[model samples]
Target chain A: MENDGMQNGNENGRESAQSLAASPLEVHDLTVSYNRRPVLWDIDFTVPEGKLIAVVGPNGAGKSTLIKAAMGLIPSASGYVRFFGRDLSESRQRVAYVPQRTTVDWDFPTDALDVVLMGRYGRLRLFQRPRRADVEAAHQALQKVGMEQFANRQISQLSGGQQQRVFLARALAQDAELYLMDEPFAGVDAATEAAIVELLRQMRASGKTVIVVHHDLQTVQDYFDWVLLLNMRLIAFGPMETTFTNELLQKTYGGRLSLLTEVADLMRHEQRKERDPL
Target chain B: MSESQLLDFFLLRQYNIRVVVLGTVLLGIGSAAIGCFAFLRKRSLVGDAVAHAALPGVAVAFMLTGTKNPAVFLVGAAIAGWLSMVAMDAIVRRSKIREDAAIGIVLSVFFGLGILLLTRIQKSGAADQAGLDKFLFGQAASLVTADVMVFGAVSLGLVVGLALLHKEFKTISFNSDFAHSIGLPVRGLELAMTTMLVLAVVVGIQAVGVVLMAAMLITPAAAARYWTDRLTVMILLASIFGAIAGYSGALVSYLAPRMPTGPWIVTAGTLIFLISLLAAPRRGMVARGLRNRRNSRKTLEENILKTLYQLGEEQGGMFNLRTASDVARRRRIPESQALRGLGLLRRSGFVEQANNGWKLTQEGETQGRRVTRLHRLWEVYLTEQVSIAPDHVHDDAESIEHVLTPELELQLEALLNRPTSDPHQRAIPYH
Candidate 1:
């Protein structure tokens, strides 16, 4: 019986490797820490290609940390992330990241078009300026998000919804196979939210993968095909039909385990004491 | 001076004058170029702090090297500025102190250290220290040809480097996290930017000095911001402003022969800033103030128009001539204000003289009807849609009536389905 179980495990690992080749994103045993305290621990997941996925969790549940760590924006404590069965550095141009709108200086002196043009920076060789074709591509992206009319307006003058659209236009200009967005719907108008969802569906239909850090629980069933429910650690991740149950949501958002929180607090206290003893 | 001498000076052929002007101009361009990024990052004060921090470095370099070499001072100042930034970062990360407090602490502490070093150097009574005091407030007239050449070359290098890496620098400054996500080495770009800022501060110290160089970095950039919203345009305008400040400051110093160049350059830059603040299109204080005044005046005229329409309606819509005192009483305005309103109305052809009082003209009657219609429509809409008490909405409607355009009036009418009366039973005028 032991021999049979070992053979079954090897076969399953091989099958997963094959699946990883087809999936846009695969993470194994990922852990992220801030100031020596783990925010996300032992996270393992795979995102199916050409599917719209939502990563949902409570505040401080490390939903943003998961995305940032996978994109190498933040250092991970352990494990690695692969894009299409390859390391991120090897597949960078094929991926794009749309950061939260609030993360940047809105008063920056560039217009909508110039910002979208920055999306092409990754493809340009060093010391080479963007050409006319790059400008055309940026204009096309702005048109896609219906922000072409605002192409010349400085970013500071843009309304919140319009600013969010400009950021999405920048992401579209990247023309990548995989897209990751953090809170694209937060603080946007209802119309902008609808436009973003429509754009995501279109991208999925075109065989592009999109992952979003979504905060609205009410719209999860309507907006996403797959869901990853997380609260500091992976609670459940699968197709929304099989997962996304009330029981799993309760586990993810229900108050943290008293014992687990107590342990975390104690560990943090010990680490602080070790760093600077009184 | 002879005409030929004047011509020579204008042509920039004189060695001393040319060197001073060229050096100062180059310094201006480089500082302003780098300053654009610093200002956008909201780190304008960092330049001031770094400049002040350079003082102790200059003193220490003099003490260690036993010479007054500009190169030594440059290296020393760069190190000091870079160290202050590192310390500030550490304080912010390791302690609970916020960024503003950290910067404030670093600025004052470093500046205090610099003052102490300067006093110590003065006490030592070194022979070469005669000109070192000039660094406190620069003397552009004292810049030698060699210094001019070095400054010019470095300025060119700084500008060229920035131009070559414009996209990368812009990306990092606007959004570092996004840049990192795209594998752009944000940390490395930041280090390079900081280094460039330090270099800018260092080169500017000779002409603007540690005390006033910060102004050169920030004032021109700020002034340019008022003129244009584009970063490229703002940088170019700032460079032009800086060059003007430098040239005129140098010229004045040359003419006076005793005044320092640093304060004058800063003063000139401040003058440009003042002009931009008061006169720049769209964003200037004067333009905004004018727009507001015109709007308020128009509101007052429309309110008067509505009052006249109400009086005419009370007397069967004939607009019979009413006395000034009566108009004032009905409108609850002072007699003087009523007379002024009447005079303005006559100028605009909205009212005409009739015996002892003013009466609305045909055009005036039309406008009066529009204003009264707007006031009543707003009152009705506020009471119906916003759920305001009928009595409480008059004040809001009074203000809204003057500001609502024709399109808004149409929309309100459509929404309310052309209500004939307000909740208070006042007739809603229609055109």
Candidate 2:
């Protein structure tokens, strides 16, 4: 039974890969707008397998927007995304996302273990509690982040770096193939930064694809194997050795496109006009 | 009712009173259990909006059906509550109007409409409208067995739903973004939560009415939160608190003349919340105050022991006793605080009183030495690594000495190369 299962999985994988692009994440002409204001413009990229990819850009360059759109948190204006040559819904169990820590209220009445157990929520059906195996996985995930001692600590009682580690542990409990993290190292201490980098390398070594929205450009070349430079639009994407040049970094952060903001404002104005029509 | 009758009622000798109490408690449990989620979501005002918005539904249900049926009122209230939620969402999404403003608008508009309809119905002189105005502030005294059954069944359903969908509810309340990313149907779960809130409000409209119904939902949850960091324990505590408030309301209304059940229930809930705020352990005011006092006492005790040790060190023999006045002269703290600290330390066996003077015991000597070492080591660190002048480091190190852990002390010792003396040239006592 085991042999048949393994063989069937490999055959299915080959069939799916041949049917469509086999990239871990593939986005084509992705456009996302809030109301009528466009944030990301016609982004096109496909991440290679088993690499630590950094999405680097200036502030308001849609770095977080790209991840949110890929996760389908926000509706894309026009585009399609494929994960493992299939839709996100089909390969959802093999995907994990770690949002920015600030996006949630840390004062919520839940502890580290309870928060990590949320990673297993997707695997359970409706009206089902997390199984013993799921709790074990969550505990193991916490240990991996060096937060096992704080397993019962309230989120509000944790320091900033410890809270970030708890969030990473939650994602680790998902045990996914593709990981999308938003600013995982932002505002972290040196120890937390090292731990996160180590975790990312381990994930990459195990053939899991990791994508991060990175802020520090100096560390990008060292931490990421691939780089996708964005500033409201896809500027360049390739292996970090070639694409992370000084000129490209300047293009991404130096003189941003003022036209995108102007057009976004105009689009919002038009949308308002259409709404009232008085 | 007489005191004896009240006693009988409390002892459950009365059947009608028992059912009525059970109904109110069930309603309270349902509302407060879900209210924990609403409270954590920082949407406490939404419950108020939903309750107020439920008023018109009860009125409209009666007007449409011309019967004051409990089921009909619930349906009407549920519909009105649902519409209010939709209206609030639309106002937030479609326009720049914030959610609070939308809730305020919807709550007042729907309640005003319900009042207008009720006034019109009262004037029409409909026979069934005799006690229709009771929905305004609830008439717990008039609740029949049938009405109690309706409230009980709906409240049970809400409790069951909360129990079954706990994981999804907690995830969404804590972080909807993560829930959405994990494919847990974030919007649907939110809608479910609001729907449960609507049902809770609908069930509460009769025994507690619209105005005071929100207290049953919010007060219990708010009080329960101070007692626990775990959501499950919080929910259970909220249920217990709500049930107590509900029982208290039933008792007051039954025994006292002119006391409304709804307001009594709310008053009782407020009392419970106040007690929890003042007396609950860990997060309560009394506990926090005690903890702070204990911490400061330890600091004082440690400082006193260090002072006595330092005085003895300067005299060449560490076992010699020092006068309290001499001990007080070494530190800048108040004399009373030093004496008090010394008294506490002596009682704890860290120090002893001998020949009308104080001396450190062996335990106290070790502790004082550790504190002294940490202080001097920090002074060295400040001057060497932080570039602070030696004289300027003493004041900063004074407060930090007591809080430094043994692990940190080791780290500092390693980092400072086991400094022989502070910048003041005094010996850094080795433990």
Candidate 3:
């Protein structure tokens, strides 16, 4: 059954490639709602392969929500997201997600190496333990992030930079073609920042796609080749040189879209009414 | 009971004793295994609510079936427990009430309803309903061989189920979104985990009772967390702790005629938790207190060394008889503290007491200069790299000087490019 699904996906991928070379990620008219109120609205974009993309916006702009919705971590209200011309379920092995560092409890009873080993779980059969090769791959991932010495250390004992590196190492162990990271440099030290940059450069050199939810505007031009300017809606998205203009950034961050916000507020008010039905 | 009687009870020679102990031990292991996930998920109190909700089911099953068959009570309890969880989730999602409030509502309402039904059943004057009240406070003494066999089998099944899905549980418990993004069927796995948790509660309810059963579920896992940071090891330790609690509880109740088994078991679990909280190596309160004391002592010693080094510089780098009172007044420290600091330095060969006061030996001078250098180097690094104001750097440098290792000192030195002095314009001391 799984083979049939994979073959169908491959055929579909080939057909899409014939028309317009299939980008690494494609989302069309995607709208996501939480608690009956929309968080991301009518998002549409296509991401080029083998480029470092930064999704930049202000707080509550649904930057993490976009990545999560595209990966099917949360259900979309309307529209669809396709990866390599296929649904997420069909292409999960080719994609990896690095959630925010604060999303997990570091006090969970696990060491750095064990966390990295989780990256290989998607490839294993049900009820199967990680084999020796998986452990070796996890170790290699740890080494790549310069965290091998601390691999045996409890996760809670790690400093902020070290914890970020461990998270990055987990993503690297996945060996996915596309990596979506949320605020990887949020609290990391300079060394970890450099290590992450080097890792991203290597990934791009090897023809893999990376999309990061970036908060620092200064490094946007220097680090990313492509930019997706978002504020509850896609303001602009393209190569950084052409798309990351002063006007677009001003639009994304300037809070000039008050009409949109007002409409969203009205919709939320109605949603509450519908839920309560009194 | 005498010591020999205690020995015989512990040896499992008595059939009834063996049955009760085995039942409670299996109950402990099962609750703890599933409880680890619940505890990690921050749903520790949910077990308490679920166990409490099962009480009404017990009364309802007894009223309807008019028999004490354990299977009927199990099914009834499972359904009620599941319903309470569902209600709690629905209330949280559909209303402005938060999860804790929703849980509070469901736990109390169901528990209250159970009490009402239990009182009604008592008023009904039915035969074989005499011991149904024991479910409120468990009567492990009433547990027969057949009851032990059934409870043990179910508990074993729950534990084995957890083992089979250990990786899935770990992933979801750690990061649910990552698990979902990886196509791990996170919701279905959560449902499976919840089902096992319900089964665990159901199996243990007869031995620990609904009132105290939550302690069995959570205490062992919380205690085990202090011992290790590996999920598998934590689960293993939790199981062992749970078993020990069960064994001791059973033994105590067996030996004492009037003692209730449920309270004894809960007390044992609490005792284990207290021991782990106070004595476990890395996470324990005692170990942390000791570590804090050592750090503070090192800081104090370094401060005294720096004081001595400055005093020597003022005296043209010659040994002088500096009384403890003089040093204490200069450093603004208590005289007793100065004496203690000097005593420690003396033992370490950093200072020697003469007739008038304490003096720094040649080795003491070198050691004192190293601490001073470290203090100055950190101040420079903070001002230069961390961008702290020159005036704001001294206090931080004071505490950090004692903790900075040799490698960090080298890095700070290189980073500062061998600055001759700190931002304070004081000449950087060197050994």
Candidate 4:
């Protein structure tokens, strides 16, 4: 059954490749809502393979929601995500995901090596345990990220950069064709950021795809090959040289600045009214 | 000591011992297994609430049925215990009350209601009324072989359930978000965990007594954490500790007739906890303190080496005690400790006294330069990567210098673009 799933997934992937040669990931007319209100609307874009792509937007610009929707992590109101011409689940084993570091508990008792081994779980049968081969793979991944020495160290004892590298190693251990990283650079030291960028470059050189949700605009040009500028909809999606312009930045972040400030003021007004009644 | 008397004791009194020992062991195993997960989940206090909540259920069962059958009362106790858990969760979910506060509120209120019901039951005058009173503080001497068998079966069931779902439980506890993302049915797994917790609590109430059952659930797990970080090891250690406590408690209660089984078990659990608290290798307080002291001594030695390196760079070779003391003062070391640190450094052959002054040996010079190199590299990193101001980097880098590994120093050098100078434009010698 597992082999059949892989075979079917590969066929679907081939078909998708033929349809969109320029874009390995294609999202069409995507919308996402939360609690009856739309957070992302009318999104459409495509990312080509083997490029270091950045999903850039302001704080409330649905950047995370867009990635979540694409990964089938959140319930989308409408739209379809095609990965190499296949549905998300069909190509599950081929895609790797790294969530925000804050989303996990660092105090969890597992050591650095244990977490990296989890990347192999997707390929393993439900009841099967991780084997010696998996452990060796994990060690190799850790070495690539320069965390080999700390493999036996408890995760809680690591510094921020080391912790982030551990997560990267786990993702590398997955050996997936496409990588989806959520704010891999956030809260990390510069050395960690450099290491991750180098790793991503290596992944690109190996013909694997890498997409990251990046926060710092200054490093965007240096880090990513392609940029997906977003604000509720696709502002622009193309090579960074062609799409990253001041005008596109203004359009994504312009109107919301004053509007968000006004909402904050109104909230403060309502809170005051509740407290003072006058 | 008579033969018949001994026979009577063995035959008649032996049943009590069997019941108490078996019940305590089963309860210990069940509660410890669930407790391992609860301890990891940071919901250790919830076990306390469930144990306390069972009181009202037992009381209500006796009130309604006018019978103190262990089966009937335990059913009611389990329902009430589970309901109290639900209520505690609801209060936290719906209200602004924190989880601990909710637990405290539900625990005291349910227990208070149980006491009220117990008083009412006493007023009603029933033949089986005496049996209900034993639930307050467990009367292990009154336990029969049937009760032991029931407890054993329930505990075995919990153990099997936990064994089957160990990986899923671990995934959920460590990273619930990832578990959810991977389509692991996190909610169902959580419910399974909670159900096991309820089962552990209900099965334990008759043996350990409601008042002390929470300790049995939490203490063993807490102690086990000091011994191992792996979940399986932690659970196994906890179960073994619990079983020992159970057996010892029952044995003591049987031999001395005056002591209650519940208190004896609690005492045994506490003893294990105290032993773990003082002795466990990694997380134990004493071990951590000893490690800290060793690290501090290493730091002090490193500081002396760094001081000698600075003197060598300045005078082109070595420095005296006065200059060393002055440098140590600038580094915030007291005069007495600084002198002691210098003595240790001299004794260690990293430094030597010549012409009433201290000078770094050839080996000392090499170590000193490495320390200085690490310090400057860190300063450069702090300024270039972390965006710290050049002037502000030295103080922080001073402390970080002692801890930076050789590999990290190399990474820093690469990251800083192999700068030959510190942020302050001082020449950083790299060998």
Candidate No. with top TM-score: 3
Tens-place lDDT digits, model 3, residues A138-201: 9999999999999899899999989998988989999999999999999888988988999899
lDDT over C-alpha atoms for residue B16 of model 2? 80
User: Candidate 2 DockQ category?
Assistant: medium
For candidate 1, lDDT tens digit of each residue in B273-326?
A: 999999999889999999998987887787777778788988765578877787
Segments in model 3 whose C-alpha atoms lie over 4 Å from true places? A1-18, B256-258
Residue-wise C-alpha lDDT for candidate 3, range B58-151, written one tens digit per residue: 9999989999998899989999999998998899977889988888999999999999999889888987778777778677777888788887
Q: Any residue pairs clashing in model 1, and if so which?
A: none
Clash pairs of candidate 4? A16-A85
Q: TM-score (chain B) for model 2?
A: 0.90
Q: What is the interface RMSD of each candidate, in Å?
A: 1.0, 0.7, 0.7, 2.2
lDDT of 1 by residue, A165-242 (tens): 999998998899999999999999877999899899889989999999999999999999889898878887877876
- Measured with DockQ on alpha carbons, how good is candidate 2? 0.72
Better of 1 and 2 by lDDT: 2
* Candidate 2 per-residue C-alpha lDDT over B174-203 given as tens digits, one digit per residue, 9 for 90 to 100: 888899888898888888898889888888
What TM-score, over all chains together, does every model reach?
A: 0.88, 0.91, 0.96, 0.81
Model 1 TM-score, all chains together: 0.88
Better of 1 and 3 by TM-score: 3
Give fnat for candidate 1: 0.71
